[model samples]
Target: MNDTPGWASPGSAPSDGQQPGTPGASAPDDRPDDAPRPAAPTEQPGTDPQGPGSKWSKEQPPPAQWSAPTGPQDPAQTPPPPPPGPGWGNQPPGGPSGGQGGWGTPGGPGGGYGGTGGPGGGYGGAWGTGWGGPPPAAKPGVIPLRPLGVGEILDGAVSTMRTYWRTVLGISLTVAVLTEIIVILVQGLFLNDYADTSALEDPSATFSELASAMGSALLGSGVVFVISLVGTVIATALLTTVTSRAVLGRPVTTGEAWRDARPQVLKLFGLIILLMLIAVGVTLVGILPGLLIALAGGSTAGAALAVLGGLSAAIVALWLMIRFSLASPALMLEKQGIRKALARSAKLVRGSWWRVFGIQLLAAIIANIVAAIVVIPFTFLAAALSGDGVGSFLDGTGDFGWTFLIISGIGSVIGSMITLPITAGVTVLLYIDQRIRREALDLELSRAAGVQHPAPGTTPGS
Candidate 1:
């Protein structure tokens, strides 16, 4: 068996004279290019001149130095210089100059990681590094300063609650308690009369009596609705400031949020009222033709026309509502008047009608689902505790005493406490997301956060 290393064996070692496969070897003019030439081996001290296996002897002299051919030879027959070693000819291992795809080299159509001047250039290449920019500058806030996706929006809302649980939950709980109390009071005072629907089961009941009952119910509901709306507005206003500060990674007290939001409350209120008026006006206009027909005579044709008109109006109202959904946030945050906020919302939502509508609808659905999850069990428990079964409670056939109302109101409060933050947070984030996408609001947010390197030419707060 050969004891020497495979490379140092006679078959592989470079001979003293020009060897067939060594750098001094000549190439055939017609031969196709072959593998790259190997670099000349440097002589190591203490190595035998003949071979690694040979022992040094007094008679043997050191190996002679390698020398280049002095005379000019046929250009076609001369082999190219041996390839340089790693880092020897300004080429890093596995780098571009090494003829292997590596960092800063165009790996393919879209440049690979760190490649430049290609379709996919920069970090992770243009083919998408599976992320948008670098992991957004560490977010100390509820959300990162970037265009948000649905999951991110939801996460941010949750993050706000998690990061500032005391303030967020306190605000939500207070609003929920107040709203629920008002609703319960209204129901107790005004809706008690309609709580018993036994009159409707009586054969002696007249259409006028039924209409009167409905009217009373409507009146009570309207009052409660107004109160709830006011509570929601206040909560949203205060929470918007909290959320805005949260985006900058700042913690806020309930008092701080209240103080910041108070100045804009009236403006927010006016904006809400204006929006309601516009919605009501649109609805009235859309249903006017049908209303006039129905009032003239309650004929089948009139009923059909009324239905058609009301349907048309409802569609328009829905569109308008979605179109101006961001107005409240804009009004509160920007301190703009109702008209300007409405205009701002309209501009942001102009080209993104379906997108905004879909996101809003999804958020509403999620909120409702969450509320139901929290409220349904309480409702059932309330019914059971009140001596009414679930069926009777759901059917509204059982007597609804103060006990039942209070228990149900507790459930409502709990549900509201949980859902209010989520819904309000989602709405605010959606507004910010739209602005980030359209207006590059992330740059402003970054500047506000004192990020070391904000997008160039972007002034803070601009």
Candidate 2:
């Protein structure tokens, strides 16, 4: 098989016994039509005979070897196509003996494997014109080496979770169980009074009583929110490492993921807190003027301004949130500081705000839906097992006793075990997709994955 690369153009030879485009060709017929012609020279064969050592071979071959055999021949002894040379086995694309399709078609252009023609003809005849789409991309792991679509991004996330479920679930379950235990203990021991929120529900409560109840409730909720955020931060940090390796088709143990992520954990936590504060600060600034107006006895005007300002602030916050949504992955994967990670995220998100927003929103919706599907049934079962039963729980009057707390916390833990990896994986994959579109990250990933790119103009795996 001749494996040399390149295609010969398909055109007829010149009439002057020379290939077209060769150095010599008959001059254009510009001579006068009636110009005199020289007498042609003729020689007798014996008169032109040369002496010994002439630049020609004079040996004669056996007469029968010059032609094909006249009798029937054994099919098993049929010869293969002639070795690679001009015209590459004397067949053209779709010739009488060549099959109709594929590079491998017998006697087709580019004498591919399985063809009667020797495998020397290059794909010059039908590369772009006949070969359908571009070649499939290299897929080292969960995603192909290209800019990802929405479904691909989601699928990559789920694939990462499924492919490395043991390590992924281990990290998530540990973090979730620990976080939930802390929350339950804190609520049971320190917030029992705040948990009894009936005082705020009373229609005739005094303003001071209502204010106190709201403050206590806020305190309880703030504690829970902070705990949840910490758990999320830890899970994101570890899973970032796992997902990054998963992209390169590398399997990582939990210990390895932890070691890789440990250095960046504190910085990731700080970045998350900073982003939260920025959002909250914007919100506070929006309502500050209205708050001042209200304190100065302009209550009606203050309320209107606060509503309008709050909405504008919310819009700004949402924009900022989406803009910095990738910061966690950036910080973890790049081992970047809070400021640098935030800057990197903003830079990557510059031209693709809507795309990033839609992907993030979609992932969140999917993760939440999955979590709700798992947690809701467990919650109802817990309620029924508790003294309140399902009706009282739904009515919002059930006491959250130890039974309720433990049962509901178990549901929360299980739900988080399923969801944490997915959310983290999607965020990491989105970061990678953006980098691929903007910076050609796929080449780097291919190198890391040990994928060998084919040489230009050569078939892959040739």
Pairs that collide in candidate 1 are: 120-126
User: lDDT tens string, model 1, 343-437?
Assistant: 99999999989988887788779978998998888888889888877788778688776787899899989888888888788889889989988
Q: What is the TM-score of candidate 1?
A: 0.68
Candidate 2 local lDDT, 291-329, one digit each (tens):
778668887788678778888999999899889888888
| lDDT at 428, model 1 | 90
C-alpha root-mean-square deviation, candidate 2: 13.2
> What are the lDDT figures for the candidates, one per model?
0.71, 0.75
Q: Give the worst 10-residue stretch by lDDT in candidate 1.
A: 91-100
Model 2 lDDT at residue 173: 97
Off by over 4 Å in 2: 1-129, 195-223, 453-462
Best by lDDT: 2
